[model samples]
Target: MAAEETGLRVQEALDRLTGTGAREAGEDLVRELMAFYGEGLAALVGAVAPEALVPALDRPAAAGLLVLHDLHPEDVGTRIVRALDSLPRTPPVLVGHDPDSGTLTLRRAESGGGCGCGGDDEREVENAIACHAPEVTAIVWEQAPALLQIGSRPPTAAEAR
Candidate 1:
């Protein structure tokens, strides 16, 4: 089944429990299942060679699950880069990521004049990063340096005379 269908089914099951006054029990059951599956995923990751898992990442469902379980072979940075690269529009340059603070700093794409506005673009970036690297809790923008202009120096007083 597709991921969406599976998610809807899970929601329906939860709702059915909620309607029957067993919401807490249903949630607990879900948590237990998640723990069980997480252990399985962890074991699979340990047994398989890292390169063997790379092919699975091509499928969004598999990639998401690996990330959700924190069992993806790639590091957070690699995931972030992959996310950015997947974007249709020009992607920002990654300045740095601070794992301690869960902050990712990025410089806006300097080309195409950058739209000079960020409402839609910012949300898209956030969504992409969150989907790929949920570990990143914050996204920070790094301001590009101001442009410099070159001009002739002023003549000395003696030269002016």
Candidate 2:
């Protein structure tokens, strides 16, 4: 069957299951299929040369698949770093990661001009992380500190030489 046809069939099945229990059962079936495919993916990963897989990490969809199945050889930190490096704008510096809480801490890049709040930049970063490292449940942003200037007294008219 075509991919679209398969998707439609799945949606039709989901639609038919109206009750909570039936819906849960359908979701469970999907999860089972996902696990089955994940195993197949693991086997495929094992068959392929490790170097060949490295290139796939650069592509978002492929990388997400690899990460989803936990078949990507690289560690989470390495993948997170790769995601950050791929950012179009100045990438944030990784402050730390708490695996227990699945929290990632990052220091936002300082902008030469503009508010530097980085609302859009943060979203991009989050999207990249989701693609590469879905295991990160939360992101903590560390805003850049304000610049401080030393106080200086202007020379008064009487003090002028």
Candidate 3:
């Protein structure tokens, strides 16, 4: 699991501990650990940051940490464009990037065959953006999602030959 997934799981466990006296202990432990490690991460960012951003973003762990702390040197729009360009399949056409709201709008490419999965592509894209460019708070699809058609219906009891 990624750092984000691990943190979410830990948070869920902590929430379950609430109303039990151990909750405070868990909370304090988390706070202290975060402070200790966050300080180290900040120092590391200051010390070894590459002059170019592509290097930092190319490393998954480093990219996640930079995004978690808002220390990435690239602007939100640039990151969004880069993330889209990295997609393996037909990439979404860039509609717009709103820095003020941190929302990215994308439309389906008109020339490609549709996956017909009803926005699974969008969700995957969103997840990817969250990993590589957490600055984007939301992704809005300007085009309607493609819908998959299931195979022909199975024969009923009376319809069987």
Candidate 4:
């Protein structure tokens, strides 16, 4: 589905979950469906965001999903969780892969949690980490062996759209 359409669906799901004049879908049901859609959207955005940078940088590998590296292990995990949890009712999914171990870990955003409600305040730290980290990789959405030595740039209008 298109990003706008998917966003609408998420809003509808939120409305239903909150009983805000939406058809009486159960909260649990809405949450489940919203979670699914949000995760998919997150993956799509993750994949596309980096592509917009490739043309500007003249690097093929730069056109992939952004990943945080060189962070303290605990910091990496916390930031991942925090990023996921900051989404609205339809929170995004975070999938992290460790290439050396060939391990992939999946995490869901925590509903109604601390990080989910703070908006820009919470994002400040995340933005900082993304800014200061030079060892990060931009992995292709679903492919592993993350591209090394590539950096993340701010999302462009096309990518944000």
**Best candidate (score: lDDT):** 2
Candidate of highest TM-score: 2
lDDT value for model 1: 0.82
Compute the lDDT of residue 82 as modeled in candidate 4: 44
Any runs in candidate 2 off by more than 4 Å, and if so which?
A: 1-21, 149-161
The CA lDDT at 25 in model 3 is: 54
TM-score, candidate number 4: 0.21
Over 1-161, each residue of candidate 4 has an lDDT whose tens digit, in order, gives 46576567667667676556455555544655656655664565556654453343222122112232121223345544444443444433446646455343433344554644445643543343344222333322332233368789989999998
Mark the regions of model 1 whose C-alpha exceeds 4 Å error after superposition: 1-23, 43-47, 151-161
In candidate 3 the C-alpha lDDT for residue 12 amounts to: 66
- lDDT (10s digit) by residue, model 2, range 89-134: 9899899999899999999777778776778899999999999999
Q: Which residue pairs in model 4 clash with each other?
A: none
Note the residue pairs that clash in candidate 1: none
Tell me the tens digit of each residue's lDDT in model 3 across 10-111.
676566576575767577657655655666677776886468556768576777777777777677777777677767677778888787888888887665
The estimated TM-scores of all candidates read 0.71, 0.78, 0.65, 0.21
Query: For candidate 2, which ten residues in a row score worst on lDDT?
Result: 1-10
